[model samples]
Target: MTSWVDMPLCAVDTETTSADPNTARLVTACVAAINGSEVDSRTWVANPGIEIPAEATDVHGITNEYVREHGRPHDEVVAEVVEALYVAWESGRAVVAYNASFDFTVIANHSPGFEVRGLIVDPFTIDREFDAYRKGKRTLADVCEHYGVRLDGAHSADGDALAAARLAWKMPRVYHVLALASADSLMESQANWYRERQYSYIDYLRRNNRPFDDVSVEWPVRTQKATAA
Candidate 1:
């Protein structure tokens, strides 16, 4: 039986135009394949066919002018990204991301025909579960720092994605329980972990008289509304 650490890992991430997954447009994306110590990465930049807001550009450092000059067509980039993910899945590798829900949701919305397969690993969810009581932020940079993983470019899709894969590789070494679980089991566990976190936050909101409806428990990607049959 292949241990979790020995299995191949495919990490995906995207830099988008907004924080809301429903509205954000993908500006850049990266998919990385990791086998033991070797990694191969591919990246794409697209002119999302919409304005790249100053705020979004500030985070990812990709300006509208720059993308217009260098990026490929939006649909073309989306297709390639989807194909990369499909290849990774077909290779029996686990797909990883730091905050998977946002990245996967944006991609699903953009590439409507693309369907993701294989095990999904989320370092963000796993970190929350393993260190539930730990204080402060849990951003990719923070988690990488905690695990002593080098994150060179910070918000760039390629940098963040590779760092996430490295962090996932380090997780089992730090948490023995993670080493005991298979990829499928870990995926299911992450779903439950996210649900518990959302419930706790909802309770806090209600206690403070704040609106807390519409929270989702889905992992990797939230369930979208179905078309009328």
Candidate 2:
């Protein structure tokens, strides 16, 4: 039994300019945890080189103009974020993300020029694996709604990431009870499932008749405007 206290874990989340991991730029990143009644948090914002679209800006609040004026260099900030995340993992802790595939893919796409190694516990995939037969979908919001978890900050990277961490903490103990597999095993299982079964997570939810609610109806204030100066 892995007690939450015994688990060296960090929650990670990223808010990007778009949904495409290959093209979207990471605008914000955050890591946080609640340890025995004590909460700790860290966050960073970067100026992705690509243009921050109006639609994207409407969601995250970062604009190209503001980024140009106030944001740190994208690569430098990403390096810092990676360093912080790696430190947490190297210390024998697991990095947790709501939908790790999205975040990890984005990181990998942007980090081709750098090196990073760690296993991320993507609770999204885990939930789908655990609830494969339940029909519909298991989005972070849906899961949070089903489990009575309060989702704060919506699309803000830190807020979403922290919510994910809490959800990971509350994952039904039944999961941990099964074979105590390594993180690699879990990832492989998810990848195999995705490859073998063309399971679009959205389709899974629709089939299950689970309600799909938009996690963010409107963006947060984290983004800046790049409008005419």
Candidate 3:
């Protein structure tokens, strides 16, 4: 099987009203195509049917008034985003996302019938597997800096989506393990990696006698707040 490094990639990202995926309302999103060269993407702004908090607006620079004036209806935007993902998946492009669970979970909650199809390559998970002990924040900006991928727009969905794809494309070059494996293999490995990390954190929480009930071990998305370990 050919490595994902040599294959076409589909990347996604969303900017929302809150940092928590379960409660966040999508303000903007982008679906991008990453070939060997660069990312080409389509972006959307949605009214989200709610106020965009000052903090959230500060992060993404998307205000409620901006969306209400220029954005599509929430449902319409979500449907189009899902359809774009379907188009990429149908073309055999593995979805590239940084901390995919957040974006996927948010979209799934917004659209009840949304289910992930095809392969997912999450840089957030894969980076940990490749360099388990690196000590720094793994936010998209941080990871982009670590990988030497230029990130021009920090919080905007379109820029983040493109940057994530660029980082994923750079991973295989730095980690031979990633370059040798197929997308299916990478996806399975990431699932185990995420599960193992969850169990380890669960153990740490138990040792400290802290709350551990809300952690979800599901990869790509967790439909609800549940743990199985």
Candidate 4:
């Protein structure tokens, strides 16, 4: 199949033990059409090796007992997933994810003994690039709601993957612009944009003699101790 963005673009996603991708196991995977049609789709449930916590189960609906009883062996399925990713990456198609960093990081971390390759396309990062003025939340549901796209199923990997693909189709201008940017260029653009914003903030502080230096510079919170606490 011709890739939606390039060649058979993979809309990959997973349900894991937790939010940390490294420690999380690939509970499921889905590949869908980037152009609003459902194509080859796949889902897998793995033992994860680690016990599935109730909270995680509550989120994705995969429970420890269910996985232990019906899922494939972890290593074998993970190997297959890795191989598929490598093939897609080699084919020059982008892997789509909502917050790609987390997904990529998780996949990379979990598939340590496996081999895979692919360039990742993260809508979260892309939004930061094109919609700098966009305010409020940017979850998949939010994007779907904003774009008038229907989110049929959520939480499941297949559903989220398809939703992400549809979200891409909804924001063509942003997607096309980023698709043309090299990875380095895209990251550099984000860095420069944030750098400018930081400078503006610093200048404002300096002009007002607001003791900006005394204010901590740590992200999420200005005060390191406060953040830690």
Q: What overall lDDT goes with each candidate model?
A: 0.85, 0.66, 0.87, 0.63
User: Which parts of model 2 are misplaced by more than 4 Å?
Assistant: 1-5, 113-116, 133-137, 174-179, 197-229
Identify the leading candidate in terms of lDDT: 3
Between candidates 3 and 4, which one is better according to lDDT? 3
Every model's TM-score: 0.93, 0.76, 0.94, 0.71
Query: For residues 1-229, could you state the per-residue lDDT of candidate 4 as single tens digits?
Result: 2333443457777788887553577666665534335477767778888788888888889888888898888877777776767766676666677776566556666566533344555565556556767888878878778677777778888888887776655564545665566544544554454345455567777787675543322221112211111
RMSD, candidate 4, Å = 7.1
Better TM-score candidate (1, 2): 1
Query: 1-229 in candidate 3: lDDT tens per residue?
Result: 8777777998899999898888887899999987667667899999999899999998999988899899899989999999999999899998888999899988998887887778888989988888889999989999999999988799989888888888888888898778888878888888899878877888788788988888887787875544445
Question: What does the lDDT read for residue 106 in candidate 1?
Answer: 86
Which 10-residue span in candidate 1 carries the lowest summed lDDT? 220-229
Give the best candidate by TM-score.
Answer: 3
Name the candidate, 2 or 4, with the larger TM-score value.
2
Which runs in model 3 stand beyond 4 Å of their true positions?
226-228
Question: Model 1 over residues 128-226: C-alpha lDDT tens digits?
Answer: 998999888999998898889999899999999999988888889899888888777777888889877877877777778887656666677877422
lDDT of 2 at 99: 70
